[model samples]
Target: MSHPRNTLRTSTFSCTWCRVSVPVATADGGQRNHCPACLHSRHVLDQVTGGPSTCLGAMSPIAIAVPRAGDWTVVHRCVRCDELACDAVREDDNQLVVMRMAVRPLAQPPFPLEAFGTL
Candidate 1:
């Protein structure tokens, strides 16, 4: 005997910052947890326990991380709890925002740029 296929259900969520209706999956059918337009996410899962999180804070996209493996990830910080989270960057994600995050460290260095002249 064969099992019946599960019924299809709509999967979408509203962006916490931009208020845009977003699909839970990307154009290529990969899972997407953050808004593509704004790159904002919600703290719904616990990073430490890998379970549900009660914080439910709005996650702000702070920076971009490109690992040696060549995939890019977005760094998020919880506004309410200050918890940090990382999510894979999808192709549908806003490129402008991604570039801004990637270049932020170079544009606004923690230390004075003048110090680099001595090197």
Candidate 2:
């Protein structure tokens, strides 16, 4: 018996920051774009062109954004190219890390907090 030449193979990518092997898909069958543990991603896809990117920079999670639709997305910044990207939050993602990013703005506000007390 001869086997078919056309076969799909399992694919995985290593996290640029955490160095963890992440599956291409999540447990709920959703596509994974970043690591669940460290939440870091590789700049391998161009958001504007929707094609493979040549930057290959390490993307760092900067903030968490919640839109009116009630969906949360993690905002990342490319260390090399300074590009910005967003990825959906997975169920298996670390809650502590996500919370930290969410409260970062309040924790370290751009303006001094004493200004509010004067009023």
Candidate 3:
């Protein structure tokens, strides 16, 4: 089935199992949308990010997460489409990345998550 064409530019989507925003791919000049670091995606084949596609396969995470988190989410860059996105470490996500991302605290706190939380 084809996805609806919404007026808004941002297509509200996330990992089917994790329910988190899949990163928009920039490696191909922002024409892909796969999760880097984790190499996972929702299989939304497109010439650009936030678009529609017929491929519905859940892009699996084949790489490691770089431990970048937001207010309550962790970022991953996909190896497939080179998409850079964030997931909140869901139970449904790959156990390895989930466990690895869980250690974000050991990192530098992931940018300005605290600042965004107050907003």
Candidate 4:
């Protein structure tokens, strides 16, 4: 019941923004602990949320993918680990926010719109 990272209190949990639960590290097996939706996580790991990050900065949504069960997952880049984790987005997640995050890349030109206009 105790993980080495007990000092590291990020016992993965569901994201309020997303309704899905992510699997947390458990003795029996991995439990869905993180929310699969919006993939936006609070700063609870630092012994404080909405405060300075011992890890430095809020978690960012870096990648998106479709995993088994025909479900979608969002990958979060941990500032501390520089590690990427694919978390399932819950169905109840803010659809607009999720869609905006999903479609955000397309709106931005890879090379920058200013660069294209100079041509």
Top candidate on TM-score is 1
Give each model a TM-score. Answer: 0.84, 0.81, 0.30, 0.46
lDDT of 4: 0.58
* Full ranking by lDDT: 1, 2, 4, 3
**Which regions of candidate 3 fall more than 4 Å away from where they truly are?**
1-39, 45-49, 53-71, 91-97, 104-119
Residue-wise C-alpha lDDT for candidate 1, range 11-114, written one tens digit per residue: 67888888998767677878888998889999999999999999998999888998889799999999999999999999888899898888888986788999
lDDT of 2 by residue, 1-119 (tens): 12334246446778888888877767887888898889998898988899999999999999999978967899999999999998888899999999888888998788899899979
C-alpha-based local distance difference test score of model 2: 0.86
Worst 10-residue lDDT window for candidate 3 reads 23-32
Whole-model lDDT per candidate: 0.87, 0.86, 0.49, 0.58
Total backbone collisions for each predicted model: 0, 0, 8, 13
Model 1, stretches more than 4 Å misplaced?
A: 1-9, 112-119
lDDT of 1: 0.87
Q: Which stretches of candidate 4 lie over 4 Å from their true place?
A: 1-32, 35-38, 42-58, 67-69, 111-119
Residue 26 lDDT (model 4): 48
lDDT of 3 by residue, 1-119 (tens): 12336434544445555566643334333433444335356655443556775556565543344445433345444445555444444433346665665564656665766678678
TM-score for candidate 4, please give it.
0.46
